[model samples]
Target: MTMSEGDLAVTELAFVRREQIAPLPPPAMTTGPLAWVRDNLLSSILNVILTVVMTALAVWVIYEILDFLIFTAVWSGADREACLASPAQPVVGACWPFVKERAAYFVYGSYPIPERWRVDIFFAMLATGIVWLLWLNAPRRDIGAFYFFVIVPIVSYILLTGWPLIGLEAVDTALWGGVLVTIVVAWAGIVVSLPVGIVLALGRRSRMTTVRTLSVIFIEFVRGVPLITVLFMASVMLPLFVPDQWSPDKLLRALVGIALFASAYMAEVVRAGLAAIPKGQFEGAQAVGLGYWQMMRFIVLPQALKITIPNIVNTYIGLFKDTTLVFIVGIFDLLKTVEVSRIDPKWATPVTSTTGYAVAAIFYFVFCYGMSCYARATEARLARSERR
Candidate 1:
């Protein structure tokens, strides 16, 4: 409709703004760190009270821990007297001196001092392979995988146990102890478990009845029992069934048991990841003419494994700590060494056991926390890549 002459005359007298209004800044309460604090910690009166109480408690606990670990700790000297409270030092905290004295024993245990260099070499090789594999941008990652999953284990075996052909002395597994044994048990379990778990997970889902049945039986049987029982059976009962000459080393048995136990748990984690995948994924892969193995490997397994990284890492962390259980079989792991050291009459003091346990706690925390951090980083990286 055309504007009437009278309307036009009135519109001409009215003023109209010609430019867009500038946008206002976001509200002050919604845009800063203080906003986060307020929203999360002080959103309600009850939350405010809880936050203050928790913060104060945290600070107090931290202060107490630092005091026990550092402020009153004994740093040097020989024997129990060094850690004992005296007139000169009226209070004692951690017995750093005790840890200092037994540091070598804690690392090498009964492994011969001169031959301990072999263990050091193994550690270096293991670290090299791990860094090579885990460094996403590193060159020749396939070779890194080979180095980590294949060469390292073989060379490590020869290096740690010795080889006559290589002019190395044979060090019995009985002599393996301390951090050496602990890392060995954990590394073996971690390395073997994942691939075995994948196969078991696949078998559990297989169309073949016999394969599925066997997989289910193995997984259920292992999961039904405690790890300590597995350790005992492997370390003690297995030898009874095998020929005397065919019997495995005690450490070997425990390693097998640990690997089996972890694989069972890992299989369940993998299966959960697999179940989370939609049927469309399987159908789409087949629609593209992919074979069963190719579909699983390229189209399915990667997604499944990635989905379960957190659970996989959780199982690994538990297995790492579970290495301490080998002590029940007379294997001297890191904790076992600490246990042995605390009982030494020379260093016996009120604080000796506490200090030893504190060291063990720190060791476990550092490694487990490192694994957790790495897993989180991997998850974040994967999420970023997917978003792009």
Candidate 2:
């Protein structure tokens, strides 16, 4: 029964430590930016190839864009001659002079120069309302909401179209063109789409047979048709329903078409978000003695809308871009203005069309990208709040 000294020595060597060991630094290859690069960029041969190829492609694209936008772009001149390539001038990218000369036309699109101040005031008021409403923590948000939802549209009509009774001579909607027209169409679509879409979404889910059926019919009919069809019908066919003199403004008709089309798409986006919400949410709201409308207004709808923020913003961006389609019906939005100006004998050059389109592209990109970024930030903020 006696153990040998060699056996006791082996048992002593295998003893466990009682105290905790201090943590050691991770290996250099697995702990720093190098580690991140290793794991994400070069973890495999395929990944390494993809990373390298994509990086080079991005660099080339960026360089080409900069070269066209800045390096070779014409900065100033008096006429078309400024943009034309010469033996001395060599390469020319954008025709800045053309854009500069026709800047007013691009923005106002033959809106009476004498009355353009009204458009300016309209812009100022719109900017004010948008800033106030979008500032998140802005003071007097209720007032901002009132100004945006109520006062702006009403006042904008009277201010821009003019109230002759108030000494402001009537500036016909026919004179509305360019940025003014684009903004009008987009603003109407974005503002009108959300509330209308919410209604349609709720209707689709409602137990009432008539409301649900009507909502389904409308959403399907609108979604089933192209925006062009709606616009054409609005601008051309709708007038047939009324006497010639009583027909609505062409711009107004287009506005209605765009709003309706956008609302239909928005309804689907919202419905998807609503579907994602658990039935427990509805039950919980009801259990708290909240009426259907109150439960939706205070609980369900907010969560649904928040979840669908990206989709909603995406729809807004599409509607914004689709404003260009108004030109088919003789309504001159920003793109139409660009189309008209590019053919002018005074500023026309090889680059004129390219330049005009470039400006429109930049404008659309800025606005769309802004909306996207705002939506992303909103999503992040909501996520943080939920985590808290």
Candidate 3:
């Protein structure tokens, strides 16, 4: 169609100029570190005030901690005298020398110095197994699980307590104290509670009336009582019910008590996870003609456990810390060993108790923090796999 003269003039006037149509960069207010700072820390006046206040408080805390832990700390000393300042001087810091000297007692307890290599070897094996299990893309995980679940426990028991048939001197359970006892109790509780808890959780969901009732009763009863009561019952009252000829070791009693207590709590965590699973999952498994156990094994539990990883780890951390309560039943754990060391006249300085506690706190923090990190990593991995 031919255009009128007026329309043609208007079209020519509306034509774009190429030089005036260049690409433009993002706004300065929406890019780079400065932009991020503005959007986050300085987004509002209140945020800016909070950020500055928090930063200053953090700096002050860090400086104070570093000053106390490092600046005036005594690195090497012979005894209480070395840790103390002369009348002419004032001192305030950790007596690290006592920690250094008593390190073996804290780690091995009364474990014989000659047999300490066994503990070292067991720890090495534990580290290897944990690394293998937790490492992403690791090989032969099945073999690693077998070694961890079966061979390691058996071999570790023999090594730690010795084997007469193998011509090794036996170490009494009474001599087991400090971190050695703590680890043993905590690990046993963790390993035993998981399977037991799973069973209880399954039982709680069972169609059988008796099974569900019993599971409820047990879970409620155990969960209702304090852990200290459980420990006392296991240590004191449990012996009365058994035959006089059959005596259980103190460590065994503590382990059983801890395992049972932990299992009760763990069962609830597992049950919550199970409840979160959609009914469609169970129905889907049933649609394929899968039996009850088969459906749970293949579909329900895997999903449930993945969902409950955080809660499971939390329970485990609590159980690990609870191992310290064994001290009430006359079993010396890490904290108990520290307390015992503090009473020793040789190392009795004003700072001895605080320093010992600090050491114990560091040990506990390292282990608990590792577990937390593993939980986070596992959760991230599972989330990625689900996205895929």
* Tens-place lDDT digits, model 3, residues 313-347: 99999998888899999998999999999998998
lDDT over C-alpha atoms for residue 182 of model 3: 91
Give stretches of model 3 more than 4 Å off: 1-49, 87-89
Candidate 3 residue 160 Cα shift, in angstroms, is: 1.5
Ranking by TM-score: 1, 2, 3
Looking at model 1, residue 183 earns an lDDT score of: 92
Query: Where is the poorest 10-residue window by lDDT in model 1?
Result: 72-81
Identify the candidate with maximal TM-score: 1
What's the CA error at residue 128 for candidate 1, in Å? 1.1
* Cand. 1 Cα-lDDT: 0.95
Encode model 2's per-residue lDDT on 335-378: one tens digit a residue: 99999889989887888898899899998999999999999988
- Comparison by lDDT, 1 against 3, better one: 1
Maximum-lDDT candidate: 1
lDDT of 1 by residue, 1-388 (tens): 9999999999999889899999998988897988899999999999999999999999999988999999988988888989999999998999998999899999999999989999999999999998998899999999999999999999999999999997999999999899999999999999999999999999999999999999999999999999999999998999999999999999999999999999999999999999999999999999999999999999899999999999999999999999999999899999999999999999999999999999999999999999999999999999999999
Output the lDDT of residue 184, model 2.
88
Model 2, runs deviating above 4 Å? 1-36
